[model samples]
Target: MQHLDLDFVRQQFPMFQTELGQKIGFLDNAGGSYVAGAVIDRLTDFYTNYKVQPYGANPISNRAGEAMELGRRTMAELLNVSADLITLGASSTQCFNTLSIACTPLVAKGRSAAAGEVIVSEQDHESNIGGWERLCQQQGATLKIWPVDPESGELALEDLEKLLSNKTAIVAVTHSSNIIGTINPINEIAALVHGVNAKLVVDGVSYAPHAWPNLDVLDADAYVFSTYKTYGTHLGVMVVREDFLQELAPQCHFFNMPYPNKRLDSAGPDHAAIAALAGIGDYFAALHDHHFAGKKGLPLHRKARAVAALMNQHENELCAYLLENLNDLPVRIFGRKTIEQREANIALSSPKISSKALADGLAEYDIAAKNGHFYAYRLLQAMGVADMNDGVLRISLSHYNSLEEVERCVAGLRAMLG
Candidate 1:
């Protein structure tokens, strides 16, 4: 509310001033946030100082190894989960791929023949949905689809309830709609999936940047998100429930001891980026401290709640300005009409201008916007916007964006739309 310490926060990101020769305004934070200074410093430190295989006798290797362990705990704290249950990987796709493979053993040796199916909603990104589809194909398991609402850009839980049966071994869903900006009811979805004795997996790639997740309270068997989207370096983080971790087979070696967290990570990661995620923990904790200065009793949920409240309030104002100005301009909003009803990502199609042409035009004015489906195919198809594969011109906001900038953006768009 106090304008987010503009100089201090902006200083944390050196790229903001230098990118596009200092004139570009970043409106694509939902795609990926600019890395903060703490993350950059941590990444550089990993390369120059602790760049070695961890846990070896060498002093540097031990520190590198320690850095990795510390990073795990930091990630755990960030997600409000146990450190022992966290698995780090290269990307959300890779992590989900490895996870699906690990679940193969369970489906293969199912206690009941019916316990081999996995259910997925059509609106999820290719990252989570594609891997499961391939896994189901190979395992001779049934892949069930849950319908999404076309008009509201929302998932239909009643459809999901009808699809669930004893055969459903796992249920995977996106925590948010990247294309339409709808925040799905993941907690309720998790409850329904788990009630049917199925493991609930969540794709948080779009949700995690704007929300600080509470893994223990969220009730998902496993959660996945990308560090880059969260303003950290590039890496994939998976938080698996301790009990569910036991069901996953090892990915590394046949003789590898069964550890819940280690077994699911299939590939070796870039130590620099994986370690840089530690900075995000530092960033969140610092923000919490700033928001709750002199207050120590607040737990993770409260701190996260405060931060989210500020962000939502800030982002809503931006989206309201954009939507109000864009009204009657021959543009059709891709999601709900107001940001309060959805996240602050405004995706719109223009009858007068090609989406890409408008995106480029905005770029020429030093306004950074994007035009694409954002990989939410089912949302596009349901909304009947699939023909515009480059469906909408997108402007996604974050807490750091200012009210003045929103006005500037609306002014620019009005001129461009004219």
Candidate 2:
């Protein structure tokens, strides 16, 4: 029965203190979230004090190296996974691309015993689909689509069943659709994918912002999410299961190849960004302490899950309120009309007004919603949207978002639709 303290939550983000941030109702969180003040502090500290090459015999270099390692270890702790299993990259797209290339050894001609097959979902963003498609083509492997219901934009579990076979080597899908907002059954999908002896690679970019990832129970061979979307610095965090990682060819330099964590890191990301990740852990710990009185001693991931429950509850209430109010409007909601089986993210378009026009109108109200394909072009196309460029108007919420913000958005939509 512990409700999230919105005031306390908003205080943690420095953006809310600014004039422009206070004026705008930011509903574009699906693209990226505001960085926490703690994260900013960490980034600043790293640049100010230890802005040199890491791990050298010099004292300053050692401090820099230690800071980056702490950041890496903290992220692993946040996900309840081993540090060696996590890979940090500039973006999830880059992580997936590196992974796809690393997978070449599994699918390339004369690389493996069979011509491998890779299955991608129509419900996923291009970040999860395109790389695998190109890999399949390059390797002379078959590529299969797990189609969504054209009308509903829901991917059927039965359709996925048909795609699994002995030839399948990889199945790439989203943990939740960035545009559709529906949370896919990744655990069930993992079970099915593993039955065919194929590795499951999940893009958790959309899901992690709403719910901090728990890799301990999830059976996915690799799970990827963007830290920038999770109130941290801009970076992609990919956790590869030890066994699956051992099978892929290393993407790093020969000297770094021996390190399992560095194997998928094709290009080293910003040092300060990596160090800033420690702040995300700090932010979560602060939230957990504020909400839960006596469980301060719980592990980092446990604390994160506790905090995530409150966040999900607050976001779902706002989402349901927005959906109910929009019921009278002419806009066509793309995913579940209710909050059931969906994140706070919602996408809709209307024949009465163009998506761009609606977005522009909301801007008049100082609302920060957007209209576009949002990189889920295939999903929008499958759902029969006419203008892929304009796509659907998206209202993606974060924990820091308030009911007042939701009201402002609903009011904007009502005035525009009417």
Candidate 3:
């Protein structure tokens, strides 16, 4: 495998050429990533040329409709799912909430004395946990939490098996923790959930930026991620298996129930944003061609996987360096302190200084690190961190980050700790 061409990769993102991007080491990518130039250009083109109501019987309208469909088709191709199965929404939170509402009516039926069970992971963001909890409460279903190991910040599969029973109707979890950064085994979990005839919904917002997961291989009932976090527009992309889509009640109007794409979205689609998301596919194809020359004719998903492999290798190197330095400093690092078990997100609490103080100090060195519970408030509270207000300092990285940037971040942390 060829090593990532950092220069070629950095050129795709216009942010790196900006004065602020040049001066600051952006380690707060988990909050959101800088958009690629392709996405920006596409958004501009849509508004300039095709800003009409799509699917109408006119020239500009037809072009607008084609652009919107192209985005959906490209995203579906990248995820290895059918185009009709994918829905572009406002955000991942909205998507999950809509899904929960649609599922409540269906799953509430045939309940036993124990009530139907929905298993959620404590490590998930509020988007994944809260919606299901609300559904369970409203429908008189039991909500079970799959707890993570307080010391290691790991979710054990054995514990998940214990929670599984015949009453389980749904299991919601994250593909990777936004705080801990540990990559969960979705395929295994999907199989386990399927064995009990329960639906599995995966939150892929954090993981999707690092890797474009093959939904066919994962076989999840539903999967969701944010395009803005993956170098695209500010919209959420969700894929539901056809059978699963049929199982849920329509959240949209009665007339739209026949249309799979419109069944879940309550409002009109973001036409410009949906059209711009095709840029993600454009960026991925560009990266693949640049790294592996003449490897053309491959499917979009295969190209995405190829680009992902290159990104993962580069990111792991950066993660390894940060882990070594933080471990040497003896900071209380959360999650697995190894590259093989986690993504590039690392959260650490300093015994000598408050997390907020450390984050504030790092800013002086032009390192944009963040300190907070990061919406995984329950995870922090469960880990016995007394200062949830201060939380831990999180250093999140993406493929655009370089070794030199990692060294600079480490140097900043070292100086602050010293």
Candidate 4:
């Protein structure tokens, strides 16, 4: 298809057919996206048929093991990376925590030549920052802040350069800000971090939903994202580069050290959630088939890339429309006023009404949105937001969201602001 077929795209998600779902315009997609029908089917099938302990002697166990392996492989395939590099956990926060523990030798005081330093961006979600902070505290290592432009809430490459030194062991940041919606230049950041012999860890939770992570090109030592935000089950995927993996202290059981994928997987999340991830691959394949021609021979990751292009294009249009309308309103948009270098996600505050009040008004109109610092508390605090609790109203979007939904959001905001 020349453009994303919105009707066909919306149908893949079962939520749009429900009573409340039909009534409400779902703009709070950054929190979590509605599960695709394929994902639901796989999840239900797993629970009903083979919910036994996997990789055991029994046939059911073998089948369960195969299903779980397929799920893991699907994630690796989507990212175009080796399956052994992918580690699944409860959530991205858990993954990052495990990764930090794994890096104890690199960050700890006597273990390294000097008390190692770590840099975390001020614009990052707490999931990416807090784990490293706690790790540094325990290890007596220095934790440097890569400050954001207080007015724009955007991180500067120059600030990160100043923070990077030979003492820097790790530089953790987000692929995109949940509140500001700005997409950081990961490649450039990676180059700078690598130049100083520091490893890069990117939290891709917000960016993955809008644009699938191209791990093939992203030069980070580690990358993490949540499946729940990508229209699948709740699971965090962490992909560690082989060289980087060897540098970290083993995070798993002694016997499990041989297994590359299990090295950083401390939290063995639900088996069904792992099995259900194959459905995300299924969902993307279906979209690719519907939109493009003769991609059957192509690999899953390449097909996903093609499908993501369509999704990104459609979302950019919706975002542009939303920004244009909101520009005339009495609201202060936190990030770039245009769609450039941003996702469809948006955050704003209005002088006429509190963010909480604006959110409440939108709820009356059946438009889904919420107001909070959204775990980007440091960024909002730097931006001079008075109340972190009532930070800003975030209207996050997904591929299934339509122009009509954005219009409803704008109209609701107009009513409340006026």
Candidate 5:
């Protein structure tokens, strides 16, 4: 019930100060979020004190290993898992690739016609789909799709059930779509997939920013997200069920390997940035203390709930304002019509309006956003906007964006169309 202290929250992010000389209106949050001060501090501190090899006899190296340990503990708590199950990587895509490799030998050897299958949604970000798709293509495994409904941008459970069978190996989907902004019922999907003896893998890159996931709630086997999207360092974190880790094959150098966690991070690790991810957790703790007002118990969840609530409210208002302004214009707005009814993303299209031209036009008036498929190529194709090679103009928002910024964007859009 507490209101957001926009001023205080904005201060935590240095980029809000117009560091780029001009007022940079960043609506490209779906691509990557701006880093917070606490995250930056951790990155700086790590580079200063422990920029050396880890797990060595030297003091700096020992601290380097310890720093990574802190990150493991911190992210585990944030994602609600044991530290042993947590693995840090360069990006979500890379980690999933490693995961895909680790899961290879487990795929059915085709002794019978009902060979194992991996169920991937057509709506998944390329990172989620490509790794698994390529795995199926090369491994002689079958790949089944939970296709997003072309009109609604949603995948129905019944459709998924029809596609699933005892041959199911894995069911991978996004917690939320980066394009259409629809939140998948991951918990329900997991139940359905698990009934068929398959594991669930969730891509939380978009959801992590707006909600706190209780890994237990979904009963998923593997989950992944990019820390950069969570107000933290530029890193990706993956949590695999301990059972899954043990069953999977090694993915990295054998002599240098420690555990399944190590085998999964092919790039070794970015100790400094990983430590910075812990700092982001510290920042969240501070925010919880400051924003919870009178709440008690489960501080992390309280903070997560408060932040997500505020963001949802603010983003809805912004989307409403933007949609209202564009209503009479030639633009064909995509996704849900009601702002509060949708996730914090808005896409506008026109019969012949070039998304690039609209984006470039907005840039001239001091607005920033993206034009094109945005790696949500399949979603665009489903929405029938794929032909707009430039795609629809996208305005993605986070909690930090303001009502004033919304007005500025509206004005810019109006001017461009005029």
Candidate 6:
């Protein structure tokens, strides 16, 4: 396999050319990534040419509608699902709230002698956990916990299997933990959840940037991720299996129930943001072409997989280097000890200094790092970090980050600690 060209990859993102980018070492990619130039161009083009209401017979309206549809189709192709199965919302938090409400009736239907059960991981962001927990509370259902291992920061499949029961209506988990950065065995979890006749909902927001999830391989009932985190516009893209889509009660108006895709999104769609999401396809295609020149005739999903493979390899290298340096320090690192089982989103705490102080010091070296629970409040509490205000220092990296940057981050930390 060909290695990713760092120079070419950096060129695609206009942020690196900006003054702040030129000075600061941006390691907080897990929070969000720099938007690609292609996405920006698409957004601009939409506003310039098709700034009217979509889906009408009028020329501008038709073009606007077509652009929005193209974005949905391209994103669906990236995830290996049908365009109608994809729903674009304001954000993943909003989408899950809408989804949980829609799925409430389904859970109510499954309720019998025992309260209809909903199992959620302590390892997930609040965006994933809160909505489901609230839904369970509202319907007087039993809410179960699939707890994570506090020490290793990993979730066990055996624990998940024990939680599954015939009354289980939904099992919500993360494709990868944002704080821990360990990639959970989603397919295995999906199988266990499905065997018990429960639908699986996954939060792919953290994992999507590192590697695009193939919903076909995952077999989740529904998967959610934000486009902003995946080098595109600011929108949350959700993929609901057709079977489950029809089962959930519509959150949209009565007229939209006929259209399964529109049923989940209650708010007015952001026409420009939706249209710009198609640029993600363009960005991936460009990456594929740059790395695998003259290799044509590959489908969009295939090309995405090819790009993801290279990106993951490069990210693993950065993760290993960062872990090696941290291992030598007195800091307590979260997640798997090996790079093979984790993404580049690393969280750690130093015994000598507070998380905030360390992060502040790193800033002095022009490194952009963050310190907080990062919305993984429940997980932090479970890990014995009672105080959310003083959370772990996070150094999240992306494929665009170079080995040189990793070395610089390590040096920054060492200087601060010493």
Residue lDDT tens for model 2, 72-146: 999999999899999999999999999999998777563365788899999998998999989987877788999
Looking at model 4, the pairs that clash are none
Question: Mind giving the per-residue lDDT tens digits that candidate 4 earns over 22-80?
Answer: 88999999999999999999999899999999999899999899999899899899999
Q: Write the per-residue lDDT of candidate 6 for residues 181-208, one digit (tens) a residue.
A: 9888888888898998889999999999
Which is the leading candidate under lDDT? 2
lDDT of 1: 0.77
lDDT for each candidate structure: 0.77, 0.93, 0.88, 0.92, 0.78, 0.89
Cα lDDT tens digits, model 5, 1-418, are 5676778888888787766613877787877888888888878988998888888998989988888788777887776667778778889888888888778876765545766789889888888888888888777898888888887677789999999998888888999887777778887888898898888899988777766566767777899999888788778889898877877887777864676567576786677888777777776776666777566366454466556676666667677777788786877776666654357777777666588888887787567888988777877787777664788888888878887777888887777675
Superior by TM-score: candidate 1 or candidate 4 = 4
Cα lDDT tens digits for candidate 3, 1-418: 5899999999999999999988888999888998988888999999999898999889999999999988888888888777888877898888998899888755574346646789999889889999888898788788999998988877889999999998898999999988889999998998899999899999999998887787778878999999888988888888888999998888888998889988887665689999888898899999998887789788888999999999988998999999988888858999877887789998999888999998998898888999999889888888878988899999999999988888988998888786
Question: TM-score of predicted model 6?
Answer: 0.97
Task: Select the stronger candidate by TM-score from 1 and 6.
Answer: 6
State in Å the error of residue 153, model 3: 1.6
Off by over 4 Å in 1: 1-3, 19-21, 108-115, 296-305, 386-389
Model 2 C-alpha lDDT versus the unseen true structure = 0.93
lDDT of 5 at 22: 31
Regions of model 5 farther than 4 Å from truth:
19-22, 255-260, 293-302
Better of 3 and 4 by lDDT: 4
